[model samples]
Target: MLGGGGSFRGGQDFFGRNNSNSISRSNKLIKSPFDNSNIPPFPSSTATATADQPIFRPSMDTDPDPEHSFFEPASTSPFTKSPWSSHFNSDALPSPADNTSFLPNILMGSLVREEGHIYSLAASRDLLYTGSDSKNIRVWKNHKEFSGFKSNSGLVKSIVIGGGKIFTGHQDGKVRVWKISSRDPSVHKRVGTLPTLGDYIKCSMRPSNYVEGRRRRNLWIKHFDAISSLSLSEDQAFLYSASWDKTFKVWRVSDSKCLESIEAHEDAVNTLVSSIDGMVYTGSADGSVKVWRRELQGKGTKHFFSQTLVKQECAVTALAVNDDATFVYCGSSDGVVNFWEREKSLSHGGVLRGHKLAILCLATAGHLLLSGSADMGICVWQRIASDHFCLSVLTGHTGPVKCLAVEKDNEVSEGERRWIVYSGSLDKSVKMWRVSEQPPSTFQRSPSFIPECSPTAGLLVNAPSFVIREQ
Candidate 1:
C-alpha cells in the first residue's frame, strides 16, 4: 500500500485493505504533520559579538535612547486563543485577494468528474476538456461549471483543439471530430471521422508520382493497432499520430489525407508533442524519443519528413514545453525527467530525479514543471537563477496520476501571483491545494467521485470528439 510521507507497504492486499493481524497502528502510521521535535543542536561559540560592539560604524551618532521605541502593537492577534475557533467562521482568515499577487505562485483546483478515470486533459480559453478510459469525453466551463454532452465508446487517448473543432484519438482505432458551439448548448455535433491505419499497407508511392497524378490519398486512419497519441502543429495545419503499429503518421486535417508516414520507433509510440519551431517529438515504449521535421519542396508537392533528433534511452511517456520554447521537458517510465534545449543536440540541461515509479504525465508553465507519476505523487520544480533548481514533492494520490493541466493567471491583481494545477489520477478523484510560503505538511486524500470499475484512465481536453467507457 502507498501511504503519505513516502512509505510503501507491500504484500498486504492490492485492494488497500490491511490483512496482517500483526500490524499495529503505531508501526503502520507514518510521521504526522505536527511532528517537528527533531532538531540538531548548534555548536557553541567562545567569542560572540553583542549589540553594543558594532563591526563597522560611522563617525556620526550611532546610538539611540532605549526608551525611544520604533514598534507598536497591531489591532489583532495573528493567532486565535483556540485552534478550533479559527474554523468556526470564514471571516477569521484572510481572503486570497488580500495577499500580494506575486507570491504563493502555486494554486490548484479540482474539476468535475466523468464516470471513469481521466486520461488526458486540454484547456482553451474558458473551457476545460477531458477524455477518459470510460470512452467518454466531457467539457466544463471554468473549474466550477460542468457541461452536459459526454461521448460514448472507446477510451479517449489523445485530444487536440484547432479551427474551433476538437479532434480525439480513440483506443478503438477511430478519430472523430466535433464542432463545439457554446452559444447554443444543443449545437454539439460530430462532424467527420478520420481514417485509421489498423493494418499493414501493401503499396508505396513516390511523393512526386502521387502529386502529379492527382491521386486522392487514402486516410491514414487505418491503424494496425490502437492510436496511442496525437499532436498538432502550432498553427493546427497538420495532425500527427503515433500508434501501436510502430509508425508515426502525419495527416492534413483539411483533406483528411495521410501526408507522410515514418517508422519512427521500434515499439508503440506512447506520446507525441509538436513545438512552435515546427518540430515533432514522439516518445515510444522502445525507451527512446524521436524528433521529426518537415521539408518543403521547391515544387508544390506534399511536405517530406525526416528524423532530426533522437534520445536512445528513457522510455519517454510524457512531454511539456516551457513558455519561451527554449527548453523541452520529457518524463519517462524510468522515473527521470530530462530537459533538452533546441540546438539539435542530444545533451540534457538538467535531470529531475525523485519519482520512485514511472512518470505518466507532465505539464509546464513559465519556468516551473509539474510531473505526475505511478508512485502516486506530484513533483513541482522551478528553474532557479537560470541554472540552479529547487523541488517540492507533493504526496496525496493513492494511485497513479495520469494527467495534469496548468492554468496561468496573467490577469491577477498586483501583489497576487496565481497558477492552478489540475491533476487526474487512477484513484478516481481530482484534488485542489492552495500553495503558500511553506509546503503543506499533510496530504489529504480526495474522495472517489467516480465509481470503481470505470474504464476512464486517460484524459484529453479541447478535443472535438468525446469518448466514454466502462471498465
Candidate 2:
C-alpha cells in the first residue's frame, strides 16, 4: 500500500480517486510499499504500555479439550456425491483421465424466487446478481433474500458490474446502466442508457456533426435483435454490448457515448471479453473467434481487426482469457475448448474435449478452467506444468448452464487457495461451487471473502512448440 494503512484503505484511495490525505479514513500509516519511512514511535516504558491493557480469555473451543472438537467426519468427503470428490493424482502438468480430480465441489445452490430461466449473472461486494427471462433481476446472498431491481423492457440477456455501476443488456436491444446510491447500496438509481436512439422524429434531432450521420443511422441499425452478452475493460473505461444482430458496439462509460460499432460476426455474436490492455475477444455462432485491438487515436480510441481464429464451422459459444492475457480459451457448440497463445503469431493451442453437448459458458480461476454446457453439466479442467486434463464433472443443473463467474483466493498459500464459482442455469437457479486444491478448515469455508489465484502459464497449445510427446 502506498500509505500503509491496509490494502482496503489503499483500494479505497485508488478506486475513489481521493487525495492521499483523505483516503486513509483516519487509519495511521506506518510506511509505504517502496521506502519504509517511519512515523512517531510510542514510548518504550513498560508501565506506560501495560497500564490500560485488558486481557481477554480464549474461547472454550480452543481449550485443548478433545471434547471441544466439532462434528463427525472420516466417513465421506462433502464432495463425494458431487463428482469432484476425489483428490488429484498429482500436482504436475501430466495429462489426466476422464475421471481425474481437480478438488472442486458444489458448495451450495441459490434458487431464484421467480420461476424463470437465468440468462446472465454478475458479482458485487457480497452479493450475486442475476438477470433472468423474468422482468426482475434477482440478487442472491447465499440463497437468502438480499435485494432486487425490476425491469420494464424485455427479458434480461447479459449483465456486468464495474465502476460502481451495473450494466445490463436486454432482449429489447437496449443497454441500461444503474448505480448504487451513495446513501444506500441496495437502492440503485437508473443513470443512463447506451446508443439512445429515437424513432423517425427523434433521429432528426441528433446533430449530424455530433453524432455522425452514418453512426446515427447505424445506432439502431445494429442490436435491433436481443443483446446476447456484455463485457467491460479491466479499467471500466468502456462497455461492450454483443447482440444477435451480429454486431457489437463499444461505449465510453463516463459520458455514455457510443464509440465504435463493429459487424463482428457472420452469425450472432454470442460472447465477448475485453482486457485492460485494449484487446477484445469475440466469439460468434458462425464458428469463429476474432481478436480486436483497441488503439488510442488522439482523444479517443479505435478498434482495429487483428486476427481471426477457429475454422471448424462449429458455433463458438463461449470465450475466456487468463489473468495476464497470455492464453485465450474458446468453447464451441460441439463441446470443444480451443486454447490460443497471444505471441508473435496467435498460436493455435490444444483442444479440451469433455462435454457431450454444446458449451454455453467458460470461466478461468487459478489453473482451473470450468466449462458449462447445454448438457446440464459442468466439466472442470486443470492445467499444470503445461499439461491440461479434465479434472471432474459437476452434474446437478437440470437445464443448460448459461453463465458463471469466478473469484479466486489470493491471500492464502498456493495449495490452500480456493475460488468461488457462481453459475446460473435455465433450471431457474444459481449454484455456487468452491474449486480449490485444498480446503480451509474442517467446517464450511466462508463465502464473504473474495478469491484470487496466481498467474498460470501452463495451458497447452496445439502449436509445434506445445506438442505432447510420449515418455
Where model 2 places Cα greater than 4 Å from the true spot, the runs are 1-103, 112-114, 197-222, 409-415, 438-471
- In candidate 2, list every pair of residues with a backbone clash: 93-384, 349-461, 349-462, 350-461, 350-462, 408-451, 408-452, 409-451, 409-452, 410-452
The alpha-carbon deviation from the true structure for residue 54 of candidate 1, after best TM-score superposition, in angstroms, is 67
Clashes of 1: 47
lDDT values of the candidates? 0.51, 0.58
TM-scores of all predicted structures = 0.64, 0.67
lDDT of 2: 0.58
Off by over 4 Å in 1: 1-114, 148-153, 182-187, 196-221, 298-314, 343-346, 385-388, 415-417, 432-471
lDDT of 2 by residue, 1-471 (tens): 000000011111111222233122333221111011121222221111122322111111232212112111112223222111121112332222322432235343334323367777787657778777654566545334445566655667778888888888876778888776686545556676666543324544555523222123433333666677788888888988887666788888887777777888665666788865679988765557899999998999999999897755555668888777767888766666788777636687677777766677888776777888867777776665444655456665666677887776443444455677777776666666656643212223223211122112222222111111111
Q: What are the RMSDs of all candidates, in order?
A: 22.4, 21.4
- The TM-score, computed over Cα atoms with residue i paired to residue i, of candidate 2 is 0.67
Instruction: Score residue 152 of candidate 2 by CA lDDT.
Output: 58
